[model samples]
Target: MYGVILKIINRLQRNPKRAATWQYLKFIRLNRETKPLILYPSYFSVFLILGFLMLASSKGLLSKDINEIGDSVAGLSGVLAFLWLIVTVLLQNRDLNLQYNEIKDMRAASESQAQSLESSQIFQTLEYLEVKLENISEYVRQRRNLIIEELENFSRQNRIMYNGNTMLDLVDAMDYFVVNSSDKDALEFELSNIRNDFTYQSYLRIQAIYLNIEEVVVAYEALMINVPENIKPQVTKYINAHKKSLMVDWCDKMLPYTEKLRHALMRAVVKHGIGPEANRHFLKIFAEKDG
Candidate 1:
């Protein structure tokens, strides 16, 4: 019996409206009227007095003079008071039942809506990632040799020119080839020198790489927008791995004309939309020359 009572009490605590009804049954309360303070005690006193008198009469402890009338009146009044208490308790339970149903329905609806929102976000992410993967794959497949050749050339030139490999060396090379051209046409003339030195080929390779920088930037922006929160870190890490070469290509586009093109590509990212630690290995060049 005690275990059963404990289980019922535990269940009541989990249901707030029903718990309120249970709490009311265990305590006496006042009405909103000013008479409340006096009214509660009066009702309680009546309840106690009637209960005591009824017990006395049942035990035959009442004097014979008052017994006949007092006993009959006590019996009827006690029965009426008990019935009224039962009715009040039932009314409280009914009110609490309405509240319980409302809360339960609201909770169910909220859960359904949240699940729908999560599903929609996931679907969008998958669609965006699919298109992005295709673009990245095609870029790599087409530009793989050009990218490798120029990066190798950059590495070799850096050691010879700077006495050590560094971003400054690469930055200076790009500026010499592209940025410091006396005029826009001068850049075409120098790299297209009449003697046809092997130097022209290298300059052309660098330009080729920079041309793809816009596509890389577009893909980066798309991932940032479309990826969901939970796995964004892993996805970002993978994307960042490829960012190193992109940055190198970025340097090529630093010339006044090239920067305009780069900006155009970044803008196109809004319309065209779109890695890992291999970036860290290459990006150390930039990191080492922060000043």
Candidate 2:
């Protein structure tokens, strides 16, 4: 019997909600039990005193006898008072347990909602990363087109010079003159200069292209790694507001070699007397060209 009682107590302790309801029920039972045990006994004591008072009035018993009856009633009433006290104690305990369980349930629900909110935040972060990657890819394509157009403009200018009176190098002369002049000696010096310039510019151009490609890759990685779950929207908003400035900054940081390449191209154009104004006009037109 003791083992069974202990098992029941343990189960009640494990579930506070059930324990609270059980306590409330126990208090109700106590109040019902107290009504009979307290009120009935007190009522009987009152009725017995009244009967004694009436007997004393008719028989003229001593006042001492009446006092003894009063004392006896007081003793009986004390027992009823004790029963009421026990009932009140039980009710207070039950009320406290019920309130505690309500608070516990509220806390559990709040924690569950917080976990769901965190999961939604993580999902949105991944979505933002996907969108940023797509934008970066498009931006990289535009940069590549800009580089190619500049190079194409340079080649077109060289071709125009070759077709005109001035063939500054053998590559240009060969492109235009292998049919007109068979004199191999006439092309040797210009051919050497063309070979040297071509080698140097080719190296610089290749390096610049590779560096720009690396910059795009780094930006993609930064987007993937740096965006926290809750702050992705803010990150995306800033990127969108300043995409052009951000792209220029990324190129500067990741493609420092581009400045040297630009200088080399300028030097080659100047040595061929392409002139600053002509080069500037070509750059403007190249920027306006379709990608």
Best by TM-score: 1
TM-score of every model versus the real structure: 0.34, 0.33
lDDT over C-alpha atoms for residue 26 of model 1: 58
**lDDT, residue 119, candidate 2:** 71
> What are the runs in model 2 whose C-alpha is more than 4 Å off?
1-70, 138-291
Misplaced by over 4 Å in model 1 are 1-90, 140-145, 156-211, 223-291
Q: Write the per-residue lDDT of candidate 2 for residues 1-291, one digit (tens) a residue.
A: 999999999999999999999999998887677745455655666786688668766766555577876775576568657765786786678879989999899889898988787777766775776587567767766765554443444456444342221112213422332232455543332322332234334434444554554565466447747566566665556554444544433443434334333343434444444435665466445434511
Backbone clashes in model 2, listed as residue pairs:
none
- Candidate 1 per-residue lDDT, tens place, 1-291, comes to 999999998898889899998678655443444354345655776786688678767877655567666766787678667766766786678779978999899999998998888777666665676577656755654454454455567657543354233345434444444433455554342323212122434444455656654445555666678466875775666556555544433422444444433233222222222112443343344434431
- Cα-based lDDT at residue 245, candidate 1: 47
